[model samples]
Target: MSIKKNRLSQNGIYGPLTQKTLRNLLKKELITNFGFENMHIIADILIDRFLKIISECSVEKERIKPYQTIVFAVDRNQRFGYGKTMSQTKLIPVTVNIITHQELEELASGKYLKDLRPKIVTRILKEAYAQGGVLSLNDVAIICGVPNTIIKKAMRDYYKQHPDEILPHIGTIFDCGATMTHKRIIIKLYLSGLLTKEISEKTNHHPFNVDSYISSFEQVRGLYEEGKGVQQIAFFTGFSQSLVKEYIQIIKELNQLQNNNKPNGLMSLTS
Candidate 1:
């Protein structure tokens, strides 16, 4: 019987078999050796054992030193062995280079850094700004294979040196703490529906700061609906009573305008 050769090697004694052929051969062997009834159970046991062996081999392979090579001989005709007798076997020597995860990362990073040029950094920043005004230092560092600290320093230095060009692209810059505090106050008062007094007390911030934080929303009628007087709203929101009353009046006027702007037919339908 002529044996089929594997694509990897023409003269090897045992070549790789296709998944379908291997399965069919295993099924036939199990049926002949253990009968039809016991075939599936025996095959399952064999498969589980083979999988365990494969997992162990994978772990051992990982434990091997990086760049270390292992040479081994494989018998190609082992599948044709029958009843203590073996067919003419050919031994093929194979060499495998072992590489650890860290080694692979280092090699990949080296290649990335080698390919990256000074102009590429500027282009990366430009692309980042085009996508969004904000760019992540860690993301850019990962792409360029540089440390985040180095990337941040380089960006800050570049922006300072060329503010005319870089500042316009990057957009407004504010202290992170101040920006976060401003957002937190707005979210607490508006989205969270917390009282201005509650936000001021919790944040230990001035009432004026809270009012300024929520000024962007341009409305404050909910404070009045909550049964808070103008004085109380001013105390909590950091706005003067006059400002609070003014804001409430503005909100009322805006509501009245919206009501008047509705078509008479739609207003009648709702009524």
Candidate 2:
């Protein structure tokens, strides 16, 4: 049958167009929610969300029909590049069924949003592990809001760079593979102050958090103009107490270093 023009609200089923639109809308909401600065990246978020929803539905009791073809739109700015937009080469697609409105609503809800955080984290971790052997604690904090404690605990006994290189634990319908570089990149981006949601959009790895090959930042400017401590900043940032302290220390140190580097005294006997 011709692809339906709109989402099947009465029956609660979604067609390709409906699915695409929902993906876009959901991404827009997520971008706003995360306070990301760009709109072009909406496409990235849409793609990532599409993969996640499909992956979850594919294996669950409510199976969705397998799509014969999938399309990914190219960004005008093309942050990654024309070649990066090609999913066949850059991304490894997993099988999944179409999603229902009920499921979508559940995920989109305010309460369920936090639960999905790890999934986004997982996706970036995949890339990081592939690119490098290890990822930093600060990196994990940015993408998933996962505290460094969880990352450290997860890394127990495993190689620091390639810990849990092959596992499928997040909100996916199936297993996937990741490398050390991928995990490292995830951590790097997190430390660089890029949120998982934003990176997901940028990387075109929709539904990024997966139980694939493996598992695995930043300066604290101010305390929201309020008299809050590490806990408050951590709460707002989804970081651990130790991480918050570390970032504050780093920023303070950098400032101090810069001040110290300034010319201590004016030169004398200048012509």
Candidate 3:
């Protein structure tokens, strides 16, 4: 979104644009088997996580963290809408009164919520635009202050428009076959420090592919192995050939620098 054409504020519970981004995040997801009760609980949890992550930064770091509070109001008052009431009793989770999928669709399409601040709507619109109009529930929830369940509800509403393609599970965007899923599982297993040929056999993908996706760091160490070219290694691994080359070159340069025992000299790597 157009984010005020300036730098974001370094301090605040959430910036106005950040809040809107969070709302868009929630709106983009499919909300299956969810209601206000669950939405409120999730919102509270996400807001707390956002606050903790935001506190660690003096300004925007090279990496950005997601915050959700600025997007959806905890209540009509647009306040934190959480913590204990003055009476010291815990407040009920805020009601997300948009009860029907139709209403959420209208809001996401910019038909509703037109009268509210543009900041309340534009960020989601921008993100949806960026993603070529297909926003997954998991991706949006990662940005919003809502729980994955609420985001799933939003996504469900959107999926109602498309009945042909088989719907994907949460957090899975790849459109490969069952074999690909199995391959992914094996890759994860290996990354968790399990090094075994059995995983490769079970997944049915070549061992080189599994190694490429799961352990680039380790793969670089094995560059001296005969009959293993980085380009061929990258092709089956699902990583770009360029990245494979970069890692290989880095390994060679690192070894050369170490052998020379130079403290400070010109390095060969461009990036």
Candidate 4:
């Protein structure tokens, strides 16, 4: 049997004559079941509720396809029916074609949303560990198509499972906390007299990063003032000779400026 289809009106309004037409068809049954005063009230209530349900279903349907039809039936005696089975008694058949977003995703991917959630959680953990356990929850959520709250929960579960693998703190490329932590590690290694290559190997950080941490402070200047040569300073500080020479130059310039600011011999004699 061919199925009839109808699109729900956008404004959710039915013409006055439409209500009148339906009322006329079912007027005897409605009035017999509900008295005259309750009949109108019942009709209004049914119409309002039906409009809301259909409106929501229609929106979901539109998201999946421009137009879709869902087949259902409304039995006068049963109140509602599903499918096109003929009723023994009087009944109203309905065909509503609304597909939810979740349904669409399942159809396209051959997997239900619930089934895919575990995969997302696994991927988030994999990416987090791959990045040295230093990713933010939002970053993981964006990449894995999972919500931030879900990702956090997954991470908490993962940490419980593998507490030894958890990082002491979360870090990102844009934050200074990771940089300061790296600097502290490098300084500790440098003070232990580890060479640049040794510190880089131990920290799994680039040699250039280790050098930057060493040169960013006055430690190199103090070592140089203690009669440490360029090569000696580089060996102990994990910096290259060129970087050591640069720090030495800055120290010499500062000392020269200070000496020049001192009073001349004649001013000293007067004092």
Sort order, TM-score high to low: 4, 1, 3, 2
Cα-based RMSD of candidate 4: 24.6
Question: Any runs in candidate 2 off by more than 4 Å, and if so which?
Answer: 1-219, 224-227, 263-271
Candidate 3 least-lDDT 10 residues: 72-81
Stretches off by above 4 angstroms in model 1 are 1-120, 131-134, 164-271
RMSD of each: 22.1, 20.1, 22.8, 24.6
Instruction: Using TM-score as the measure, name the better of candidate 2 and candidate 3.
Output: 3
User: Relative to the unseen true structure, what is the C-alpha lDDT of residue 193 in candidate 4, on a scale of 0 to 100?
Assistant: 68
lDDT of 1 by residue, 40-102 (tens): 877867866765554543536555565543222222222222232213433232323333355
Which one wins on TM-score? 4
Worst lDDT window (10 residues) for model 2? 169-178
lDDT of 2 by residue, 30-51 (tens): 6777665476576585668777
Model 3 misplaced regions, further than 4 Å: 1-214, 262-271
- The weakest ten consecutive residues by lDDT in model 4 span 72-81
TM-score of each: 0.22, 0.20, 0.21, 0.25
Total backbone clashes of candidate 3, pairs 3 or more residues apart or in separate chains: 15
* lDDT per model vs. reference: 0.46, 0.42, 0.41, 0.49
User: lDDT of model 1 at residue 212?
Assistant: 55
Task: Tell me how candidate 4 scores on lDDT.
Answer: 0.49
- Estimate candidate 3's alpha-carbon lDDT, on a 0 to 1 scale: 0.41
Indicate whether candidate 3 or candidate 4 has the larger lDDT: 4
Choose 2 or 3, whichever is better by lDDT: 2
